[model samples]
Target: MTASPTAIDPAVTGRAAALDWVELSGYPTRRNEAWRYAPHKKLAELSFGPPVALTTSVPDLGDLIPALDGPRIVVVNGVVNTELSTMTGPTGLHLSSLLDARREQPDRLAVHFDRVKSQISDAYMALNIAFGGDGAVVRVDAGATLEVPIHIVDVEVPDETRNASCTGVVIELGAGSSATVVETRIGVGADFGGSNIRTTITIADDASLEHVLLQNVPASHMHLSNIDVTQGANSKFLARSFNLGASYGRVAYRVDLAGSRAHADLSGLFFGFGDQVLDQQINVVHSAKNCTSRQTYRGVLDDASTGIFNGGIDVLPGADGTDAEQSNKNLILSDRAEVNTQPRLEILADEVACKHGATVGQLDESAMYYMRSRGIPAVEARRLLINGFADQVVDEVSIESVRTWINQRLGHDDV
Candidate 1:
């Protein structure tokens, strides 16, 4: 039986009032401009109500935690996994559970929680804030540089009935602090459908944060995520995402440069095969003087898969001396594959230098021909060219081991 919307826990009732706001805000129907390119059938029809809490043994998640060697935290089905997680951090780093942290550290929660709006009226984002019960609260103390990256992985365990899960994460990076964080979503074999909703992150002044997301959900799953970040004065933030699973998935990533001399970089890659659909929307807002931003997204669509990229850069009035650039590139390896991209720039400050561009096409025929001329097979030739195209972005990852792992995952035989 499909769960009802009222299935939410009564204990979180008052706090759950936000879920109603998400539904009432607006459904992304076919007519909606923002969602027109990406259909919301599963999202609109799925029973996204809360799941019934039950005691279940935590299954073994091998090697996932060690991948994040630094201080880390793990959450399974929306609850913190203490056994597999860690609390040791830099002197300024504060890590705690959302519920317990709020009770004990209300000031920190009050300062950063929900500071970014779902004002864009995204249904999934609103629902997350309303119904999400358990989550992580992270605070990077000023001038503290963490030696390791924080790894957060959300897994959907096998179950007999279709289930809905919501997880929330709040990361606050203080002035002059630097850290790296990786978020991964994995799906196990299950008889029922799985749906997920998660939301917001905040970066403070002069701090630096490298955020990476890896999603490998099952083909029967439906996932939607929205990440909003606020950059303080002189801060630098880098955001990278890899989406590789689910029948339908959408991610809305937004960054607002609210402090002067701050900067933000956004990069992402998506791979979709079979009947999968992956939609990625990125928006960077420059609201302060001398702030800079850049965005680049690449996608590989195979079989009958489809993907979309809408990246926009907005420089507000009085935010002079801003510099922003945005680009979207796609590789379609199959005739039946499809991809659409929208790269937009809204500049109100005349003193700023802003540019945007997009390209949609097949593999480089000439480059493939050159490789084939060397007696290379057509399939292998195409793979070589595609690998070269994607390597530029993969090279940006700093960790040698992680970078090597990512390259191997992308089917690259050589560095």
Candidate 2:
């Protein structure tokens, strides 16, 4: 017998109201331009039950990446596991559970919570706000520079319930503050369920933040994520994403340059093997003058996998001196694989400078042949070429451990 969708806890009145509102608004369909290429039918048909918190042993991270000396927070099945987490750092760096923050520091959480939510009209984000579970809250005090990186690990435990899980994160960087955050999402078993994650980030004036996201879940699970960022004057934000696992995954980013001279750099590398489907959407809006934005994305598709990249840069009116660039490149390794890439730019300001381009093609046969003719095995040569193609984005990663881990995951040594 199959399980049915579970009901929201009546005790949680706020979540109940949000869920009601989401249901009334309805989910996205193929007719929606933003969701045209997504697997709308599959998502609409899936019965997502509320997740049940479970305590399980933490998995080893040694095999995934090098051991870094820093503070780490772990969340299992949408619930923060305090026992498994380690925190040792300077003062004024606040890291705690979102729920705890809300109860303890309601004033601090009020302004940042859902600040960018209104700018986005996505139904999934509404669903996350309604039914989302526990997540992390990171705040850096002004003039505090955290030398060590902070890691937030989200793990999905195998269960027969087949429920859906949601995680929400809020990050705030004060003026002149600098920090790095790494988020890793991993799954444990074959019977894992789906996940919905929403993150809201705000960088104050003169602040800097470096963020890295890794999604490595089971092939049977579905994943949906939305990231919204707002930058203040002269602030800088950098983001790097890695999508390596999932049966169906969609990641969206919305960045707003609200302050003059603010800057943002976004890059991603995705590998779609087997029958996986990966979709990425990025939208950057220059609402202030003299803001700069750059985006670069690369993908590798094999077997019957499918990949999609839709990136857009918009320079609004009166935003003079805006500079923006966007590029997406994909490599198709198998005839059965498919990819769709679109790069768009809208310039309402005549004084702005912008360029957008995309390319979708297979490896160069001539290069492969040349390597093979030089005594290199054909398989090894193909691997080498593929690695070289992906290295362009990997090499941009500033975190040494993350770069090394990604290279190893992509079979860099074999190549």
Candidate 3:
């Protein structure tokens, strides 16, 4: 007699071993330091089951690509969809799929993939590595300057059968090279049936990379993303992230300046409405001399939504003459809305300049009253003031179209 679905005994196979680790690492309480503040009880308890076979072909690339010019890579459900992406550069700039790269350059992939060694003791990170399916592989040539940006879109399509954890992406920039990357996530409706995604990036000596992350996933779905990067000598990296969707979402980022004269600028904006819960954690590590880093994050919390921000900077013992600063400012638009902001700095070096501070409050009563007294309505005045407060960080984004989109979403365009 044929065995029933549940009658089949559980077997530990190749990928099953990895899934076991993922499940164990996702436990809410013990052995998972990365999930300390942002527990995955809701996401972990749900039975996503096994990843099913890929059925749908690659989606159209027309809407995914930005209007501007640059290279492009499209990853759907954590797997690279080659038909939807573009790569522009000389032969030295290797833009290939993760599977192709793994087959061709196993040694390089082994060294660069999941090489971030930190004591955060994050179990999810290892789980991500072990279960990573396929992702984009971008390797810039030494001294090559990618004049335009690289747009990477990781979209989650609604599924009728199983929920999947999509692919991951890993990028490596060679010495003296430069590139910009834009990552966007899209989901339809309030369906809790989609994919979870995680990604990582690395920058080499004298390399520079600017990364923009946009999240507008389904309101009912859940996404937990983690990104880690390393900057070499004279390398510079800028990260601008926007969180706007999902009932529960959290993104953790870590950047290490391991070479002299490296620099990093990390900034983020989050909008929490409804019962959404969004959390962001960032860690900047300065391991060499003459490194500089800056971080700024702002958020708008409405309804009963809650947001959390924890920014940390660590200057190692031998790292001298470092300059670092971190700031987090939040605005609560409703009485029940809540925001938790924490900015911290740990420096062991004797010679350095660093500062960290955070503030959480509502709209200024005096300013609001003054605007109301002038002829502006209460809603308009509040919107104007809030937009102005967040404008400084938005202005730092290099992409004009993205900036415009962000502004429009924040209701600042009309104001």
Candidate 4:
């Protein structure tokens, strides 16, 4: 028998009530503006049974991404696997499993757990919070600066039957602290499954955080992710994402600048091939004065794949001196490929400066011909032009190992 949406699972804690609340709304349909481009038919047809106990062994992730000189936390099947993790770091850095935090640091968990739940009405996010299992909890003490990056790896072990996996991550940066966090999602097997993930971040006054999210799961899987961030006064948040895998993937980001002089920079690159579909949505809210935000996204589609980009910026009535800009550009490599982009801006403050634009088109034939006339082969010329277009976002990645991995994926490592 198929499991009901309100059924409670033993693996998750304090989520049965949330599950029941989400059941009323059910799944999203094409009528929902945020889910218009999503593959609702395929997602709705699948019947995922109740959440199963995470009994699979942790897969070796050493070969997935290049090794970096920092601490690593690994999660397999939505559960933390300490046997495969290296959590040693600076004196002020603390890394532990969410389950452990709930047991030993209940006070801290109580302060942030489900705090943003009421603010978010998205069905997928509600479902994630209702069923998510243990994830990583990372905290940096005040005035501490970590010299190395922290990596969190989430992997799915293929199951013969349809199932669901959910994970929740909480990150807090204390006042005057700074750190870099990298998250990677990957899976195996050829069977269809669902992966739901959510991450909430809080940056205190004068703190800074550089976050990188990479999704490269199997082509037979469907992935949904949500990232919500809150910034304090004079804080900085930089986000970079790369989506190059998954049969149908959707990622949404909500950033709120609640403090004066805060800044946010968001950029991403997505490549789709075969019959895959990728969608990226971003919403930035300026609620304080003297804040700034910038967003730039680029996509490349080949074969019969489709890509979508929707970004919006909003300035509140009191958010004077707000500066925001958004731009999205897509390159189509085949006649069968398709792309849709929408950029929106709502300015209620008279002193705000905001602009938004989007463009979808084929590669520059003139540039391709110019490279070919210089004695380059057609294939090489095409690759060179694509690489040049993608480098605009890839170059902004600050971490060396991540930069190298992205370059290798784009076939620009050697060049």
lDDT of 1 by residue, 335-368 (tens): 9999988877788986999888888889888888
Which residue runs does candidate 2 get wrong by more than 4 Å?
A: 1-17, 45-50, 55-58, 115-118
- TM-score for all models, in order of appearance: 0.90, 0.92, 0.87, 0.93
Candidate 3 local Cα displacement, residue 100, angstroms? 1.7
Q: Which ten residues in a row have the lowest lDDT in candidate 4?
A: 1-10
Overall local distance difference test of candidate 2: 0.80
- Top-down lDDT ranking: 4, 2, 1, 3
User: Model 3 scores what on Cα lDDT?
Assistant: 0.72
lDDT for each residue of candidate 4 in 1-415, tens digit (9 for 90 to 100): 2243243233344465456556766777878778888998777644333345455555567657656778888877777889888878987899998767766776776555554446655666766666565678899999999999999888876476566577778889999999999988888777787677788888999999999988888899888888889999999999999988789887788999999999999999989999889999899999999999999999999999999898989898899999999989999999999998888678888788898888887879998899899999999888888888888888888987888888886679544
| Candidate 1, position 335, lDDT | 95
Q: What is the per-residue lDDT of model 2 for residues 1-415, given as tens digits with 9 covering 90 to 100?
A: 1211123222244555456656676787778666777777667644453446664566765665434568887777776788877755677688898667766776766554433434446777766766665678888999899988888887776467675577778889999899998888777778757777888899999999998888877887878878889999999999888888778887789999999999999999889999999988899999999999999999999999999898989899988999999989999999999998887778898688898888888999999999999999999899999999898888877778878878887779632
| TM-score of decoy 4 | 0.93
Error of 1 at 10 (Å): 12
lDDT of 3 at 112: 42
Best by lDDT: 4
By descending TM-score, how would the candidates be arranged?
4, 2, 1, 3
lDDT of 1 at 288: 96
